[model samples]
Target: MVVMGSGGHTTEMLRITKHLNKERYTPRVYIVSSTDTTTISRVLAGEDSSGTYTICKIPRSREVKQSYLTSIFTTALSTVSSFPVVLWHRPQLVLCNGPGVCIPICAVVFLAKALFLIDARIVFVESLCRVKSFSLTGKILMFFADKILVQWPDLCKVSKRADYIGRL
Candidate 1:
């Protein structure tokens, strides 16, 4: 499964997936923000017509220009709604880069792991835009992610555990 935010986050995640071995990563699922129709369209247009993958839309944790109170409320609701989707899919690996949408999904995966419901390994790739430090999403997920990959070597200094795997 892949969690996509908007614009750059969605593009970067999709680009990384292109390199994945189709034989190994068959039947992939893309989790997108409900308002992000652009990504949904892009995925559908780019994917093979064989029905090997699909997209799942969920409410965004926070919308642009949204108030803090509303963001909090929406984030909570989004997280709750995502629980069942994550539980049902039970992906062996949950891959995400820096995206606000990833937080809630990763939280669901963490809870699932704690409850022994799923054994999904989270591989978080810090956004390529972050050359000096980790993004806010990356910082929060670092503690829980099974492996954190960074595109820039400088980011390796931010967290000893992070691997500088070069650009995706």
Candidate 2:
């Protein structure tokens, strides 16, 4: 499963999807925010928009400038809503960048993994903008995600688990 955020996050994921070998990643599942207006169109124009892909929508965990306290509730709501989608797909791997929606999806994946219901590995690709430090989502997911990929080598110093995979 691929979790995408708005604008740049979506663009970056789509770019990666384009280069992926379709045969190896057959019948992909794409998770997107219901509030996002552009992601669908962008995915339609993307190379991986073949009949094998399925797009799923979940509510955004937090909106821009929303209070962190309020986000807790919304994030919980998103996690609840994500259970059905995640279970139905039961994807073997989840690729997420720095999207707020990613938190719930990855959480569900982790929870299911803990319960031994499914085995899904998560890979978080830290956004290029986060050079020296990690984003809030990146920091939170550092311990949970199987691996975190960073663009800059210097960023690796911030976390021993993070790998500098160069610019994506």
Candidate 3:
């Protein structure tokens, strides 16, 4: 499963997946926020609707300029809504970059792992735009992800576990 954020995050996610070996990563599941219609369209455009890939929508963690209280409530709702999907799919790998939507999904994956409900590996790739430091989502996911990849060599200093794998 892959989390598709908005704009740059979505673009970077798509770019990285484009190089994946189809035989190894077939029948991909893409998770997008409910308000992210543009991302849904972009993902669909690249997918082979012949049952090779699917796009799943969940509520957004928050809207632009949304109140903190509202964001918290919605995030919790999104997390709850995502539980069944994560449990049902039980993907071997959950890939994501920096996105608000990733917070809830990653939390679910972490809890699922702790409970032995699923054996999914969380791989987080920081965006190429983040040259100096980790984004909010990246920082939050650091503890949960099995591997955290950075495009910049400077970011290697940010975390001992971070890998400077060049741009994706």
Candidate 4:
């Protein structure tokens, strides 16, 4: 199973999984922001639940806040609160689009001994958190990520396991 953030990234993540041999991949959705509109729950309740479940009610920030401290605090708090949910899901791999929803879920994956796989397109700094926090965050993900797929080759500079795949 895999966890991803919202919007185009989520769409791409879903598309990639669909091509995986169903005998191997079982896709599920986990919504990570409070305000970001997503259909993970509906998808889970309706068609997607064949081997899937919904993880709802996550706190997502709307815009980059004026106060960095406040933004960090809220994001961190939301992430910390979400640890248990990730444990319950017990996914084998997590594919993050970027920081929007993946941050918190990655933290939980860290604590749960699950693998973390990040998409390659988000090689820019904006895709991640602060540099000070990067080391620890990267440590958690890097130590466990089975693979890091990149849609862009430039991402290889920052990625731990860079694989060149077409953009999702």
Every model: Cα RMSD to truth: 1.2, 1.1, 1.2, 6.7
**Best-fitting candidate, measured by lDDT?**
2
Q: Which pairs of residues clash in candidate 1, taking residues 3 or more apart in a chain or in different chains?
A: none
lDDT of 2: 0.91
Candidate 3 residues 1-168, lDDT tens each?
999999998999999888888668977999999888799888877776577887889999978788988889999999998898899888889999888898889899899999999998999999999999998788989889999999999999999889889987
Clashes of each: 0, 0, 0, 6
lDDT of 1 by residue, 1-168 (tens): 988888999889889887898668877889999988798887776678878886898999988788878888998989998998898888889999988888899999998999999998999999999999888889989888999999999999989989999987
**lDDT of each prediction vs. the true structure?**
0.88, 0.91, 0.89, 0.52
Candidate 2 least-lDDT 10 residues:
41-50
The Cα error of candidate 4 at residue 79, in Å, is 1.7
Q: Judged by lDDT against the true structure, how good is candidate 4?
A: 0.52
| C-alpha lDDT of residue 61 in model 4 | 34
Write model 4 residue lDDT over 28-124, tens digit each, in one string: 5455466655646433433443654455566763244436556677768778766766656556556554445565666666655533432212221
Better of 1 and 4 by TM-score: 1
User: What is candidate 1's TM-score against the reference?
Assistant: 0.95
Kindly list the per-residue Cα lDDT of model 2 for residues 55-136, writing each as its tens digit.
8999999999999999999999999999999999998999999999999999999999999999989999999889999999
**Ten residues in a row with the worst lDDT in model 3?**
44-53
Work out how many backbone clashes candidate 3 has. Answer: 0
Name the better of 3 and 4 by TM-score.
3
In Å, residue 123's CA in model 2 sits off its true spot by 0.4
